[model samples]
Target: MNATPLVLAVLHPRVALFELGIAAELFGLARPELGVPWYRFETLVAGEAAAQAVGSLRLTSDGDMDAIDRADLIVIPGWSTDAAPPPAELCDALQRADARGARFMSICSGAFLLGHAGLLNGRRATTHWRHCERFAALFPQVRLDPDVLYVDEGRILTAAGSAAGIDAGLHLIAQDYGSAIANRVAQRMLVTPHRDGGQRQFIPAAYPQRRSQRFDAVLAWAEAHIAEPLSVATLARRATMSERSFLRRFQDATGLTPMSWLSQLRIGRARAMLESGDAQLEAIATACGYGSPESLRAAFRREVGLSPAAYRQRFRMRNAPGAAAITPP
Candidate 1:
């Protein structure tokens, strides 16, 4: 990687402003307090010098297709799914970028542009849930995972929808820097720091958060006591309901069962610990209620698609104490 990577955001016609905003907020804005080399970001339009955007807004692009040759990472914000195919020139530039090993990322409908470039032929990718059917039909060879917030196939990354762009952008930040830096960026943005990419985009919440006070309290209590061995009976007692009733209500409030929710919470905590500290696997496992390092490794791999050790190695803070002495599991 370059000392200061250049991130070029491609702004095609009728680009969704929110997705583009996500790219700019994440990579374009300067962060002086981060004390690290930040990305050099530019917005490029395919054709004209000025473009019309949603909400009757006009934007003068910073660069053109020629900028792609100098970019280390390229971002395609939401594209027009119904509009004509991207210009042949734009597609050719993307193909060249791919051949030279530049990373590509798409937000929501932007995956359509990638598909038009023939970049997602056999790779795993995703888009907004609303467009999954059409995207799958349009490109049957692409392994479409509609459930995930984002899919990171290494070189090509795709986000689900509007807000999911934030998650994917932070993920890229985590990749370029580390999870600690990503979490700091997310804190500045007032958003949750590290939502795993494999987490489901849609949760079947029969009662929306505004209407689920009792549900919220239960969730808070469970999270506060995440290190304890929790079960249906214990949670049922806390909620003052029968086990079956609590289970049904919990399933309705969250799309996951009691145990599944607890497991995800434990894994999330374990991930935070690994990213911010230099604790050993055995200690991290015990603190996260996994009982042993082997158990933690098994659950971490099953849920996160990477072992705890690997995740720590990939995302651990660089300046942490004892970081140099810790060996991989």
Candidate 2:
């Protein structure tokens, strides 16, 4: 029998409980029937033997720094943003494990610990947006990307904040097991299977719709007439404003240019059509205003990084409830 992979979660002082919980939920669960070998998870606490979480919740670990050397994957949960540097022993252990090919990952502010250990130098990483500035200032060599939810640079990974940790963990599972198994795990956890890591962290919860009532009306009209060759001039004429003024206001309200927003909408529609498996590529392209199948392919490849046929193959729900036309890639 093959040995199960041992995932060691190294807990730092004042670790965020929620980040630790996510690791435990994903790695600690035993699902042998899923056709994947079991994973052995051990929580290792550093410094003072025991640690207290946010609400004075004390956690005692059965393992210590030694576990890092034997781990197949090392997970650093969130650490205190205000705390001093990590100890030399922890840093050395991490460096040794990394040298020996053990994967290292961080969730939220735990990225600071990895940064301090010199593991993130010259790598693209992210933390909670609130701490991104400080993280960059502290580790100038590391390329800090604050806008995205997470970043995966093969062996090293970093996530943004609370819920983003879940996305990062699910991505790791997807890399270890195929998408189908990852989707099954996500279903069991009641979470979205895949959220592109590059998606914006916060999309402005309240978009102040009342302030842009006229713009909203114009947007609705544009959506209704996607097939029509609508231009900025046409939209400005409909709103009874100069083209320049309309362009500026549209960007300020939507954070995207009119053509860019239209392309996104068209691609969204194209994706739905591909998943439905009923519409031909050329028909879907015309319906979504791409004018031709070649245009749709170009737009889909640019936006989604995959052709429409590939996207359908990866995401279409096979054995969908309703009996729809099933087109094989």
Candidate 3:
């Protein structure tokens, strides 16, 4: 059996209900029969004695700042976009906890708390797309990727917005217990187990005015053949345009160049393969159009900041009780 990690969610006043719910659903739910131990989940309030969450949900905490000191994983759920900066005491507590090796994570606007706490400086992060421009301007040191669903930089992880919080929490579960357990939990919740953090946040459902149908057709084709080698010429041919024309139109439509979009798709596929844990690195590489394990490793490291083997080790499924399985490194 695997040991469960302790998870602590710190709630501020006027929290986003959905973000708080994602944390509760993933961590508060007990599933001891899956051969994984139960997570110790607690909701700790930072400021006021009691708070009203979105809807009719009222919340109170068991303790105050002291709770942050004992946490293994400290999560800050969504904070208000217009809210004042987090209190200095809260910021200090967060930094002190991080110095003690407690993993720190944030969802949506909660990322602002992390930024204020100094945990996000010099780290790549994401937040609600609407707030991204401001987030970038406010924190010049943090690299903000507005398109991704989430960014996990070792000890600190940040999610985009709203339901992206679920992806972030499930990712942490996968990291702690292995992909198999995370998948099972996701299955029980009826959610997609993995959406690569790099997926574009918004893709137009309908074509924009004056956009060419040729560009749309080429995009549909590219989505279908993600595992195939794609080049500007190949896409231009599919769209029946000159390479320069196709490049301009594609960028205007999708806000990304052909290769940039293709790389994101390939990385997303690679992440799915790593989470499944059944495929060999070479097989995953070929399936994702990387051609070889070495190529895949280089790409994975560049995009995810970790090797494919290390990713698989962190997210692969573990065998059930009584089954022979090598312990994860």
Candidate 4:
């Protein structure tokens, strides 16, 4: 990796100021005390000279598309609109950068711009959870992992909602420097050093949509037996109802079909085991009712957008927080 990577942030009209601030603070500021060469960051206006942003604030980029063209990494701090296509000039510049092996990153809705530039096609990416519907609908080809805090696909990286931008930035720093440097940076920023990107963006919470009557017993029973074959017929039988009635009530009660609910529960359980323990895939697969490791991988990919091993590698709990911290010999 280049020692002093040049980072350019593309700022557009009505751009998100908070997200832009994250990149600027993390990369634009000089940190000679870091004991390593840090990023050389600049802001390039995407479409206009002055951007009218939230809270009636206005911002102007110090540079232009030419700066972006010369950058080693470009950051887009979320887009203002889901419907409007990105400016032609910006798209061309991004394509040029990609061709030259320059990395691109986006915070929150900025993924929309990458989608418009045809950069996220077939790539796993994410934006804020609130706007996932619009994002997924617009770019179906982009495998939008709506649950993750961010996605790092080698050259192209993306972050989730507002604060997740910080996580994404620290992750890049860790990759370039080492975790000790990242931890020091985080200390200065007053934030956690590493919140694994694989963690769910939103926790499963009780909602008003669930059925009024408590199905605690059924849920508990299912949790204990999650490793077993969980067919709708079997679940319905346990609930003492016919399959048709069970399907209807389950949908009304949980807002998910029996099979879908089971799949989610199974994945959640498997994820817990993966994150907390070093159990082998075969054991986890059988315990999680996957029956085979191949089946487990497919399900893990579909639900989590990561294979079991990959998820464990990225998110598994450790004995020490500074495990990745670099040491000088």
Candidate 5:
């Protein structure tokens, strides 16, 4: 990879605004504060510089499909999930780029184009969960893991859905500049520093949207007292429900059990603490509601695929202004 990789976002007709915006935000925007060589970004379109997009929006590209020849990283913001083949010129450009070992990433339905170009053959990939069945049927050669937020198969990457694109982009940043820079970028964007790619994508809500709001106070309370011992009984009492009823309702609302939700919440808090500070393992373990440093290590490794110490060392933001310190409750 070059010190300054050229990132080309390939836009198609009826492209998704959110995914395209994510690409521009992650790569196109300048960040002098990072004090490192950043990506050189450009938009690529086939034929005319202007193309139609979702919401009747018109997008103009900085270059034509030929720009693929120069891009180190090519981003397919999105494509329609239908059987209609992409432009022959676009596929040819992508195939040529792939033959030369240029990296490729697809967001949401954009995997369809990569599959059409024979880029994902015999490689593990993912698309939006809703389109998994269709994607599988369309490209039987590609090994589809529909549950992950994103799949980073070295050169070819695919994000599960709309928001998963953010995770995928941050993963790329981490790969290029280390976790500290990636976490800082995420902080500037006001998003979580990291969500493991192995995390599940399908989180079903069994209750009406309004009813799920009942747990808002409980969630806030739990986050506020994350270092304290918390139990289903105590949570149920706070919500004024029986233990069994609370268990069922919580699962219905959150797609996770009360303890599971709390565990993840604690892990998120721990990750923030690890990224922003140089606190000792014992101190962090205590603040994150762990019984011991060993327990913290076990859980962090299980959830984040890194030990707390390793995570801290890799992601601790140094000398970045506006990086807030996370206070443990």
Candidate 6:
């Protein structure tokens, strides 16, 4: 995107103030304090109209919704596109823009707009949990996973709820800037750098840190020997502690039990192998100690919220710092 990335946030008569507010806080606001270049924000409304939100709060938007066709990032912050269908023209414009290659994101019910535009078809997506049943029923073709805070399907993304909007926003920032910058923004907002018990290792985060020297050393060793057997009992022995004591200490330090932490490390290794090379699934699974491709796929789906294949397609080679994807224009 030119010098400064253009983030176009969509507003409508039914937009949610909280969702829009978070988007503004993340990308719309100026942050010379960040000491780095940031997004140039804009807003678009269908037909260049102004209307009251929920029929009370007034919102004035400049320019036609078709302007999304030019935005580097298009955000449908929140809209009731399911109950009241978005205009045919607006939906068509979004589809055309997506085809021409722009990243799109939604928060809460805003996913309904992307679903309506057919951008969610065959794509993993989510909305607020309360609306999960309805969203799935309405968009049967969309692969709806109701549990994750957000689903980043390459250029098309969806978040679960109002507060998850903050998670998604911070995630986007981490994807664009580095985790250090993202953490600084989260500090300014007075929230955890990675929320909800932290995300996957493959998911961009503040990077791994050690809480204890001994435990960190054991962990470092285990990561290197991940291809071998790593039973919790074995790890406990390596840490020179009883299984019970080691379990408690490991969880306290990493927010995951010994076994769980090992699983995460294995999954992270598998992801790296998937991204950096063309190793066969069986080879990757065995090298990561998953035993088989099926086992790897199941764990990958549960932890990362997508099959290993899908994750590779979205992230392989394209995931450098500050850029998540590059769809052809």
Error of 5 at 105 (Å): 1.1
Worst 10 residues of 3 by lDDT: 201-210
lDDT of 6 at 48: 45
Model 5 C-alpha lDDT per residue in residues 1-329, reported as the tens digit of each score: 89899999888766688899999999999999999999999987655668787567798766976789999999998887888788888899999999999999899998999999999999999998779999999999999987788999999889988888999999989999999999999999999977643433133211222247889998888878889889999999999999999999999998889988888877877877777777888888899799998999988787666677767776666765888654433
Candidate 4 has a TM-score of 0.67
Runs off by more than 4 Å, candidate 6: 81-84, 197-329
RMSD of 6: 15.7
Instruction: Highest TM-score: give the candidate number.
Output: 4
Task: Please provide, for model 2 over 113-171, each residue's C-alpha lDDT reduced to its tens digit, 9 standing for 90 to 100.
Answer: 99999999999999997788789888999999887788899999898887788888888
> Model 2 reaches what TM-score against the true structure?
0.62
Tens digit per residue, CA lDDT, model 3, 113-225: 89888888899999987788788878889999887889999988898887788888889888888889989999999999986434341321112222456566777787688
Point out the higher-scoring one by TM-score: 3 or 4: 4
The per-model lDDT (C-alpha) reads 0.83, 0.81, 0.80, 0.82, 0.84, 0.80
Q: For residues 1-329, could you state the per-residue lDDT of candidate 4 as single tens digits?
A: 67788999888787788998999888988898987888888887678888888788888767977897789999998786458888888899898999899998899888999999899999999988888889999999999988888899999999988788899999988888989998888999999986643535144321223353655567777778988988888888888988999889888878888778778877877787787788999999999899899999988877776778878887676767757743211
**Top model number, lDDT:** 5
lDDT of 5: 0.84
Candidate 1, TM-score vs. the true structure? 0.61
CA deviation > 4 Å runs, candidate 3: 1-3, 196-329
Which regions in candidate 2 have their CA more than 4 angstroms from the true location? 1-3, 196-329
Compared with the true structure, the alpha-carbon lDDT of candidate 3 equals 0.80
113-165 in candidate 6: lDDT tens per residue?
Answer: 99888899999998887788889888999999877788999888788887788
Which lDDT value does model 3 have at 231? 91
